[model samples]
Target: MTTSADPREAARTRLSAHREAVLALSHSLHAEPELAFEEHKSAKKIADLMEGAGFAVARGVCDLPTAFTATHGSGDLVIGITAEYDALPGIGHACGHNVNGAAAVAAALALAPVADDLGITVKLLGTPAEEYGGGKVYMLERGAFDDVTAAMMVHAAPVDGLGFTSHAISSWQVAYTGVTAHAAAMPHKGVNAADAMMIAQVAIGAYRQQMIPGGIVHGVVTCGGEAPNVIPGRVTADYDCRAETAEDLAALKARIRACFEAGALATGAELELADVGRDYADLRQDAEFGEAYRRSAEALGRSFDLVPSGMRGGSTDMGNISHVMPTIHPSIGYDCGETIMHNPEFTAYGTTPGADKAVLDGGLAMAWTAIELATAEATRTRLLTAHAERGGRAAGAAAAR
Candidate 1:
């Protein structure tokens, strides 16, 4: 006797089978936290799991040591799922990337066995350095997403639902060079680099009032005077500027650069500016993919709280991918209410039972969404049309700019 094909029933069964392995992976990554661009152990652990599950694993992809891709099945519908494992500086696993890595892996595994039956090709891509470096941007440049039809990932948040809009972002480093001399005796002979940086910061602060409503400007002084008594020969700072769209971010960056130049001119210091990380484009959510994910999550008993207009905000490199292809970065709630991400308290709750529930729920929901997009003819047409139209509009807009 043959059984009727029920995707939901199959998904539940598959997820149940791999529950222990997924939880173990999450726990292990949490216990041994690694910093950005240095997730060797975590990467290897995930690769091993994928390889064991019959995926064709490609290690060290995109020239990144901690980056890899695992593919299963060869089908017309190609869907990509991303995993992040890099932790924050001084606060290991604070963002719960361990959960993200494990959940992505579990989702891929659950769908692997039925990929061919569902006429879908599943790819679980391990992207490193998300805490600081824009790993996905690099991978995109290196052609990791060249053939992908769609991509999806889930994020841990304080509340459940589709996450808020993210700002387009640019990361840059600024340095000032001047002559060093004794502060009290030869202050006139020495050009203070720290003074130049201070002036630049002041300029930025003053410029804030003139910026658009959603704009953000923040930075940290990485290097100041070595000692109070000595005039600093060199000073450096890192800054991140954000706006609602890529064009807006580009404009704001130009203005910010002028502020840095102003500091150099006033203090007679030489200024050097370098982009430290990837340029994150503003998020463009695909309506088809977003609705599919919403429906899948709802089917799993998940409810969404649409982010109120003008209230959603953050910065993410995933925005870059969304700009190019159909993508979604839905939030999976863990109810560590009022304890926002990147805090020590949130880190404590990252591995709790609630957090684990988010892992399963998010993974299964994303998997189901992919399945729907791949198998349902109507949904596939919508996805393709949206992608083509968005691509054309984006190209035209870029040409106009």
Candidate 2:
């Protein structure tokens, strides 16, 4: 750490200097929304901005066209700030990823000038498909995060929050196939795939009574039938199962699978359960990281007054990254009336003045958090040790394999 007086002040000044560009970036993302791994334009915007700011930019990282890594400084202590830019299908920026991504960009720019002085590396990861593809999980598995010592990101929400952990979730493409016949003439001669789906839904409803606490099952029937006059030959749906932990989610999936199998047994239909993407693990927030973030956010006049409602947060790929490193996933709040996240109505506020302020504050606070992590003795040592231990484990696993 530098001997300068409160280096956070320097980072704050740099953050303010980047204010116009960051807000413009946020509004641009909100204006032009892209989805999942197809976020080519979004990725370019972030990567270009980071490169212009003197960070080394790598595109198409981890074999994902939309994923990239931008780094400043070559210090031993590496702080990773993840930026998400993918939008929801059909709905644009409803989750305020524009705010989230821009804030992360702001943090990286703010920390760049001080990174060398602080003896820390600032890594800005352009993580895509957070809404559906689990890009962070892919990056974590493929070495995008191997050199990162600690990771952090701010989520867009209706209000500020902290220490709110997310659920472990898995999604599946469910299908049932059977023989088809005319409904009016020979309905009794045909095996009904739609009927099988109905049976499975009923079984699921009944099982809900005995379902494990904190379990969530929800999905959409993408294809139910062809016509009312014809007996359906096939039925397809997309469903997600979530639990408090990865192990519990597996158990929940087993029971859910049985219900689907029961549907097939009753109707003699073929059933298929194909996974959609990588499963997201439950988040494990590091205590010291969370505390340091709280102090930083508090100093910025952002209050964490939202009490815990006991409801588990929605799934995020960052949860998988947090399981491996010291990480903090905080909520950078703004006023959006009574609307909730993922609601299209909430999208309207992503470019508002309050949301702009959130961009600056969230980014500056994160930069400050990084400063504290580098300067504070205990957290600095702990994060460094954890990084070394992770490397050792990776080396040992490779040797054994």
Candidate 3:
């Protein structure tokens, strides 16, 4: 339903009006990088800014201290914009979460003044622990997205992309326990735990030839042994498995589990393969939502599919949201010469001029897309139908439960 005057133009004007503040937020987040579940200061920065912008901010939503929801308007048509602020372990802002967070803030601020006109609630969800923890997954389980009509967020990347798929991934903490004895004198009497790990690695390597086309397995042995002269009684390793989709990931994990079990069976060592975090489902960007975003971004002179990187995207928690509702997770690009993401080199470019432009462009583009979702009759009807259908499904599921 279009208002008397279109709100998209007003939203753009509002975004341009607050350009300085938005870039400052991005620089601040880059300067003070926080790790997963420990993004107190980072979360405070965004929440405070949103509160000042007339959003009703709720801190510590879903029992997660760093998670929050900042919202405006009371319309049933809810627009959710996710913000991630967690930095990598050693490389601060290497994944450009600073850009991601600030862009989301920009979108929220731009749309806030016009939320009522559009008959939509602009919700900025402060999601933390994207690097290591599945914060979005936790929020989903706890009902943070129960009323969301559609979700939108743009990831920071070296090249602009749309409709790209991210891998479904799972992390594991593997351990092996065995009897220790003198390595030189009574090697046969000792059940070697390191040998168990070695056998598992060998099995995995052997299985690669027959592994699924899109399956990926990678890990590191954290502890192999105490000393070479003594038989290892314990061994620990961290591992990850990725596939094209959630179903494929499940199948891949099953095969990988068998590989791990073979090590325990052959070496007579007890094995423990525990999950480190929630499994991330593969990204399934809504095509209609993505097209709207593409049009908005193109209006800002941003080009799509500019880079020719043939590789699939890495994992992200937002993929889980896409599985449930109409969602758009576009990659907002900036110029980073030869420095790939997650590297220390990439962090230095996060607050650069190019990245700043990305913050503004991406933010305004998302705002415009939201306007399109609200005013365009066909698109609005499609999304509204999805929202209603999703509600019915939820009701049915609740009844069964």
Candidate 4:
């Protein structure tokens, strides 16, 4: 007697077959965490896995060594699954990018066998430098997402559900230059760049009160004077400005720049401001896609705690992609409640059993959602309508402004 193969069952079987390999990949990345723009080892490991799994892998797709793409299948409905593996500056894998990378890989691998039947094409994109360099933004600019219908990724967080909204963000670096002088002797002849930075900080502090609710302005003085005995000639700082929307973020950034300029004008120091990364636009999640993901995840025993509007927020480069195409960035839980992301404690959880489970569950759910969107005409129509509606609203708002 011949057994009939069920697509979903077969996909699950494929995932189980590669379970050990996927977990091993996550462990390796967690053990050897590399900072943004420097994930050479992690990138190579992922590429090797994809190549071994029969994907045609291309490395350095956007001129970044750590960036790559692996594609399988030739169906009309192309789905992009993105993986991020870059670690934080001082803490490794703090944002659970190791798990993110492994899940995306597993999802693509599991869906590979059913792609032909479902009329789906799978593209696994290895996006590096998400923690600092905005790798997705660079990739987007280089036509990486040109042919993709939609993109999906999961983030590890305190809860497992959809993320409502992300704040629009911009990052910049400010450098102050002044003449150096001896502190004890000719202090009057020199302008203290550190003093200029202090002035800027004060200005920012005062400016914070005038900002609207949900607006955020934060910075760190990266460089200060060398010694206490000498007047410092140079100082540098990094500032991040955030707002509820991209337009609001732009206006806030302008005001913050004026504050930095005030520092230069008061202390007679030359001020140089450089944008550190691409502006992280506010995320506009596809409601239809999000609901589909929610249903898929719930079928696997996941719970979502819905929040009131305007209460949830973060910043991500994926927002930029959402503006152009349908996208979803959901949150997967790790049993670390009330624990903040980008923290050392959260990083430790990325390799734990709970995190491993999240990888499997999230990966399968996303893959199933992709299959549904590809094979079901109603789902595709709903997603298309949602995308068009969001685009029209955005256009109307721009025209009104």
Q: What do the candidate models score in CA lDDT, each in turn?
A: 0.84, 0.92, 0.93, 0.86
What are the per-residue Cα lDDT tens digits for candidate 2 across 177-234? 9999999999998889998999999999999999989899998899999999999989
**Tens-place lDDT digits, model 4, residues 1-401:** 11245666777889999999999999999999998888999999999999999999999999989999999999766789999999887888888888889999989999999887777789999998877768999998887876677899998777776847799889898899998999998999999999899998899899888986779998888999899978899999888998988999988988889999999999999999998768988988888788888888898898887543334567888888888788998988877655778888788788889999988998998887887787678777655565566557666977999
TM-score of 1: 0.93
**Structural RMSD, model 4:** 4.0
Stretches of candidate 3 exceeding 4 Å from the true structure: 307-311
lDDT of 2 at 279: 96
Q: Judging by TM-score against the true structure, name the best candidate.
A: 2
Q: Name every residue pair that clashes in candidate 1.
A: none
Candidate 1 has its poorest 10 consecutive residues by lDDT at: 305-314
Tens digits of per-residue lDDT for model 1, 1-401: 12258766687788889898888898889888998789999999999999988999999999999999999989766788999898888778878888888889878987886788777789999999876889999998888986677888888778665735789889888899999999999899999899899899899899989987778999999989799999999999989999999999989999999999999999999999998668888877776688888898888888886454234557778888887788888778787867788988788887889988888988898888887887788877766676567557757977999
* Ten-residue region with minimum lDDT total, candidate 2: 304-313
> What does candidate 3 score on TM?
0.96
Clashing pairs in 3: none
TM-score of each: 0.93, 0.97, 0.96, 0.93
